[model samples]
Target: MSINSVKGAAIVTGAAQGIGKAIAIRLAKDGYDMALNDVPGKEDLLHTLADEIISQGRKSTIIIADVTNEKSVVEMIKRTVSELGILRVMVANAGIALTIGTEFLDTRLEDFEKVLKVNLMGVFLCYREAARQMVQQGTWGRASSVNGKRESHRDEHLIFFKEKKNNHYRAAAEMKKYGITVNAYAPGYIDTPMARQALSVNENLSNEEIRQQIIQRGSSSSGLAVNLGTPEDIANFVSYLASEESKFMTGQAVSVNGGVFFG
Candidate 1:
């Protein structure tokens, strides 16, 4: 299925791979001209995905940017508008998971700062810039979506990460007057490249075993049994919030984790 009418341009950060890539492709399929952003080194992956988006008959632009840098993020948003006309949706999906296990206690201040800068401050920059443009456009269906993923058990950094997510609430309140709805998608145990990378660092377990562990963990918390989520699952929910149908909903984080978590 394809969305026939264009819904305006969407900027998705970290769109080169994993959940970010999936969201970009899904948004393109849903009839949004996409500005796909990632760090400078990931240009090839961004271009490949941009090609796929074009193949789907949607306009796609690859923007090499560092989300952690305020100037780069501001430019990224500016470029999107200059290239795609108007910005209606902003998906702040670029984030880094730096702490694993209980290593939060031993995590260096530098490491902690790096994660916060990329995951928290990055979202801040993207949201502010996007909102500024959306307000100037003075249009409906102006939306800001963010990603909230499952946290590893026993990770203290997860606490800070979750705290950052509360920005959606404040952003929603502030941007609603501008006709922009701010919401978040909290996903759990979805199979993505990031999950594989995290699991790969565990030399004790094979990939298959790690996969099953994830599935089992998800099944235990979810009403749906023995199933893991996909990146498209989160994207589909984002599609709704970005549309006119979900206009009444704001300041909420919708859980797309198959009943694993409630918000």
Candidate 2:
């Protein structure tokens, strides 16, 4: 069935690039009018993505806002509801790694603070605002977050991973009465620009070497076939979790990391 036959609206932060971009596109294909957001100054990219969604016969709006800024995020949520109808799904996909590849002792305090602000605080604001709208609408809704698999050197990564897990339960508990499901998708070794950039920082390996290493490591780690994932893999999972078919599930962190680690 064509995804465009589905219904509702969704807001995806950091929708200009990487997994966020993929998710936004997938949702549009899934028949969700989209409010695509990215950090300020990414207007050109957002415009391009908006055009793509419009081409798909879904209403698309470019919402340039800083997820870390309270005022901006508030405006983003409000503008989305005002322009795109009631919010049906919230994809909190905007995040950053400020202290990657740095030693604990060498990591700057400012960098750590910035990471927390964007990765943790940003998700919190989006969830809060989206939940408010969902509760007011009195319609069932879904709030899904994009999370990562464990990366030892990435302190920011660990923080967001924990947030994704813990907040799933917390949000589910609080929002159950409102008929909104809170869940997360944990992706491992997806071939996105962010993943490539993170791997590329290892100066010891060439680009092809980095790619091979990622594939090998993910393959060896997971019980499934030794294949890494694409951004669409995660997007597919998000589409299901956002759909009415997943109504019975909540407070769950579904891992799409090729079975890398099992709980």
Q: Give model 1's clash tally.
A: 0
Please report, in order, the local distance difference test score of every candidate based on alpha carbons. Answer: 0.76, 0.79
Query: What is the clash tally of candidate 2?
Result: 0
Q: Model 1, 153-241: lDDT tens per residue?
A: 52335576576667767888999887788887777656676666554446455546665765554424334443457888877888787
Model 1 spans > 4 angstroms off: 1-4, 147-158, 201-208, 214-226
Task: Enumerate residue pairs that collide in model 1.
Answer: none
lDDT tens digits by residue: candidate 2, 158-211: 455576567668988999888899988877657666666655546555546655
Which pairs clash (backbone N, Cα, C closer than 3 Å) in model 2?
A: none
Give the TM-score (vs. native) of candidate 2: 0.86
